[model samples]
Target: MSLEKQLNLLKQIDNCFLALNGKKLPSPLGVLDRYLWLHEKAPYSILAQGGEEDPYFIYANNYALSCFKYSLDEILSLPAKLSAAEENRPKRKLLFDKVAREGIVYNYNGDRVDKYQNTFRINDTIVWQLEENDGEVWGQGALFWSKEKERPRLVYRI
Candidate 1:
């Protein structure tokens, strides 16, 4: 895509993000909630949520499902770490640290494995800390597919 087109797409995505963050939507249960809605609307996208035992996937839109060759139920049942190749474990841990300490980060580029363990590149992935109203930390992440052509997007929120 041309730079202009990419910029326009980013603008549209930003608008969607803002709209979702607007008062109409409650504060997300971390990045997962936001990604879940975004992926739903952008069926060509993917979204995953993580937790303690494993990075549980709470959502995966149609496109993501097709890309990974899995149904929604199948994707949700898988762990988020399943997307991380064994060699990338250390990097994933670093990402976890950022989410734990910073509350938010952006433009993270990396590779992720799919349900079948196929690797794909991801760019512009964002991570954000999830907190309760009581100030308790939950988990954090907001990621999307790195492809500029909009082939498919996947997000991991934990």
Candidate 2:
């Protein structure tokens, strides 16, 4: 939860997120502040990944941590795919691909399984890529919610 020491990394992350804005970058603000705002103010779950040969989760706010039932270190160490059940990975991958190609994909309803095998239906997701100033893809992020009253749907394979 402490990203204060990761100033440069935070800036890079913010820059990647800003790229989703199309041709224009976001207003100037220290990356730390931006991240703090997200960590504190975001209503639902927010998950972020990083640029790596085999990418893993780099960030997850408190709500996300609670939803997934994982501690910060544990979540960050996990592959984001693990968030879904085995049968749901294909749908998740399709969503990932769609986000990569479209820059943003909204209303993505997916069945996300937590660490203890509890399944939750994540609705109204906004998934997008994180790209650097030069358009280099870093990773991705999604803002979504799991409604308590909702049941998890059958994840389609297509």
Candidate 3:
């Protein structure tokens, strides 16, 4: 499809979740709204959020869902570590720690596991800290698959 057509479609989809005035809704609902928008615009994108103790997925687009062969509910319920291969778990945790301390970490390459427990290489995954009004840190991540011969690119931005 043409870019214009795709964008129009995305806009229509976005309208269903976001208010007409463009204000976002509450926590998980707002997350879901954006998820639907991104899913329509870029299905391959993965959206994740982490806590002090666990990295849980708060949202993922349909393309991301299909890539992992998971339904939305299944993916959201999973810990972020579940996406990392067993051997990569330690490194992933270390990277998460780095993001927590520094506010953001970029260009990190690693393998991520899908629902079927398949692993895919993520070339330039970014992890960032999400802060509340009080400045407490929460974890956020954007994951994307790299193209052949090119560096891995971030599929979505937080």
- Best candidate (score: lDDT): 2
Give me the runs in candidate 1 sitting further than 4 Å from their true place: 1-37, 41-46, 148-158
lDDT of 2 by residue, 32-51 (tens): 46455556444567778876
Model 2, backbone clash pairs (residues 3+ apart or across chains), number: 0
lDDT of 3 by residue, 76-135 (tens): 788878888889999988987787677666678877788778877776565555555466
TM accuracy, model 2 = 0.76
TM-score of each model, paired residue for residue: 0.62, 0.76, 0.65
By summed lDDT, which 10 consecutive residues of candidate 1 come out lowest? 19-28
Misplaced by over 4 Å in model 3 are 1-37, 146-158
Kindly give the number of clashing pairs for every candidate: 6, 0, 2
Report RMSD for candidate 2.
Answer: 7.9
lDDT of every model, 2 decimals: 0.55, 0.71, 0.58
Query: Regarding lDDT, does 1 or 2 come out ahead?
Result: 2
